[model samples]
Target: MEFETKYITADIKLSEFKGNTFKTEVMFEHHILVWFISGETKIIQADGTYIFNAGDIFLIPRNQLATVINYPKDGLPHKAVAMHLTKQRLKDFYSRHKPAGRLQPLQKVYSFPKRPLLQSCLASLIPYFDLGKNLPAEIASIKIEEAISILRSIDKDVDGLLANFDEPGKINLTEFMERHFMFNMTLDRFGYLTGRSLATFRRDFKKAFNSTPQKWLTEKRLELAHYQIAEKKQKPVEVYIEAGFENLSHFSYAFKNHFGYSPNTLIGRQR
Candidate 1:
């Protein structure tokens, strides 16, 4: 099934998916405020997994890698409204109101479920969605500002997330890769997140692992797939995508090549 999105503004949108389920991996460039109207969303990050049901609201910080799965609930399509809080916009908001104390960033998805204040704030915009072309850009901007304000008021520690704008610093490469290799991101994205240039990432990676990034990633992913199928008793179809392979065909071919047997063969032996 195809995903559909209707933009109330350039930054605010209503997204709908009418299907069994839709899953996608994404690295958000802007902080996202999502209000689930009628659906369930499962978000898997490097550190943890989160589930949000209908009437749930959450904040996803920018530059975080996550796999999101949206599922329809109660005979309705999975529907939600997402407001993107851009860097420039947040910078503008935080300039006038200073954030006290040193900024300490945390990788977390904040949830504010059943909060009357937040629910009211988000529900107020529902009417304007039907306005379509008639809705003014200033109105969307005003709503965004209101959201930022409400977020700070509701959670004082949110300033640490919204106010601070720092790029990814140099981190331990081996640790980063081992944690995030399941994500199918470009080498460039991996390099950027690890605070290295493409050339430097390549050089540093070779020294650390003694294998090229592509080769290492493939081997590591297949190992994970093998464990999941053989030990965890998961099917090849279920394990492939999470193992970092783009498609089942590729995953099956690679599984056979790497372990000298298809994943199904391993499953049959266990059975």
Candidate 2:
């Protein structure tokens, strides 16, 4: 699980831990997909404790406090794969399509973390722990996607990993938008990047960011354009094109909306 893939907003890392304690406390600095490969642990959350063992697959949601209390075994070592997920990654995941019945609308079983089916998969991955250390980007990406698919199919609680594909993601969404605002910055493209539906993407992104994705995009373009003009002294048309606006008229309109002045006026003020 130690690899970097295009699909991964954060790199995957594998860790082998050796400690004997009933109670272990630590704050979650990032969202994590925890796959337990060996040994056992008592998962302690605000809700309660769940006994987790070899083959246990679970998720630790970001910003939620939790702890791990190890279940001791004399012969075996404790090992796990923890993939750190950035907010952008979550946003990217939800940018495309919503899967039907992917998530549980109602909460149940406070003792267990979301996505219990990962135990078997994590068990299956025991042999590949070392392969993760030298994973090819394409292979790593495929494995992660497959892992999510399995997680969706087997999970009974939490949101289906695939069910709400249209949900706004954390990392790749902003990166994608910020990267491709000019030529064809369409919602459809955004959805495709994360395997989602355009309609679903629009709904979730608007809620998460508090503006239509397109509107927000236009503003982004305008802001970038102004920065180039004010900071670099680029011409209005040049800045517009450089910022990815295809049409001068459209760029002017968006630039005005964002800055409360014509693009020309701003450039003039600078000159």
Candidate 3:
């Protein structure tokens, strides 16, 4: 049996997913504070990997790429509460209460495991999950504010991440694309993350790769998938999504078209 429940306001949510392991690649637009109630999560970023267990609290900074995999553990579903610290809310907060302390370099993810204060703040929302959309908006806002306050009190350098509101700067397109080719995102999103307009991204891409973005992305994804299937003996179903294809059928079609044979052919040969 499988089920999922979510009670979500604009800023806060309590979510539970049961049965199959779930995975996704995303770039968050707002900072996320998460409290795990059950199960486990593995988050892979460019910098490193992090695993969260039940009762663990963690903060994910915005504008960074990550692949998240959640699994059911000990017969409990992957369940957690997540709160969004939106840019506007943080601006207002910092304006009212000026942030002070030494600025630290940004880290990919912060783990605050078993903190009583944060646990209490997040646990208070459990009853509200049953309320669903009927949850009052002000209540959500207050809860987010409360979380921010608790973070500041517990971790002094958190202000460095929460108070700074800066958009992504221009980056080396080649390096960024090479590192993030496996994430399926829109061209506009890719362009924005690399600090370019769509037109400019296209132009720069053409100049650098002598190919269009779509063609280049497809070729790279397929190349990676080919390596996994042929050399690493991985199945198409296992590598499709991670290789950036949206679906198995699409991945199979593209693989056959590019390699002049089905992916299964390679798997069979390896076996």
Candidate 4:
């Protein structure tokens, strides 16, 4: 079955799926707090992989790409509650309660250690989910505030991460490319994320990688796909998407061209 999701509030959503395991690439537009209520979720980021089981709560920073896998456990559907924190809401909060100073950027994902306060905060939203009621905007905003407050109480550094609402700054082109090649986004987006104009991004990319951005990204993704299929024993269909290819045919064509063999050849050999 295809993946399905439901929105409980403008900012909060409930996602559920059953009878099939699936993988998808997600690019977060807002800061997200996820509560895994059942089954399991594996989130693979540039830095590492994170596995969330039932009752696990984690925060995902905005403007990042990740490969998410959802599968059933104990003959039940996979389920999770996701809260999206919008930039405008965060800005309003920051204006009223300004943090002392900027803190270093947060990690790709912050897995909060189990705490009663955090659990209670999540529990408070259960009724709305059960009733399928849309939370009033004001009430939802307060919930976000409460969640942020809890995070701050647990880790003061969270205040800094939430206070600074700015676009990504100019960063090392080489380093950025190395980390983000698996994201299937346009060159224009890459340019903006790296804090460079399209023309400047192309020039700097050529200087840093000795090739055009498209060429380098294609090669990088195919290389990673090969590794996942040949060494990690993953299926071509799954690896293709994770490696940033938009479709299987495109990934297969590029893989065969690069390696002088079909991707299925590797998968067939593995089986």
Best by TM-score: 1
TM-score list, all predictions: 0.93, 0.44, 0.85, 0.86
Per-residue accuracy of model 4 over 146-173 as CA lDDT, tens digit each: 9987877887777666776788789998
Between candidates 2 and 4, name the one with more favorable TM-score.
4
Model 1 lDDT per residue over 80-195, tens place: 98989998999999888898543785689999878888888888988877776635878888899999988888888888999888988889999999998888888888899999
Q: Clashes in each model (backbone N, CA, C under 3 Å)? A: 0, 27, 0, 0
Residue 222 C-alpha lDDT in model 4: 94
Candidate 3 residue-wise lDDT, 144-174, digit = tens: 8999999999888899999989898899999
State model 4's lDDT.
0.83
Error of 3 at 89 (Å): 1.5
Worst 10 residues of 3 by lDDT: 1-10
| 2 or 3, greater by lDDT | 3
The CA lDDT at 80 in model 3 is 90
Clashing pairs in model 3, backbone N/Cα/C closer than 3 A: none
Score candidate 1 by TM-score against the native: 0.93
Q: Residue 237 in model 4: shift from native, Å?
A: 5.4
Off by over 4 Å in 1: 100-102
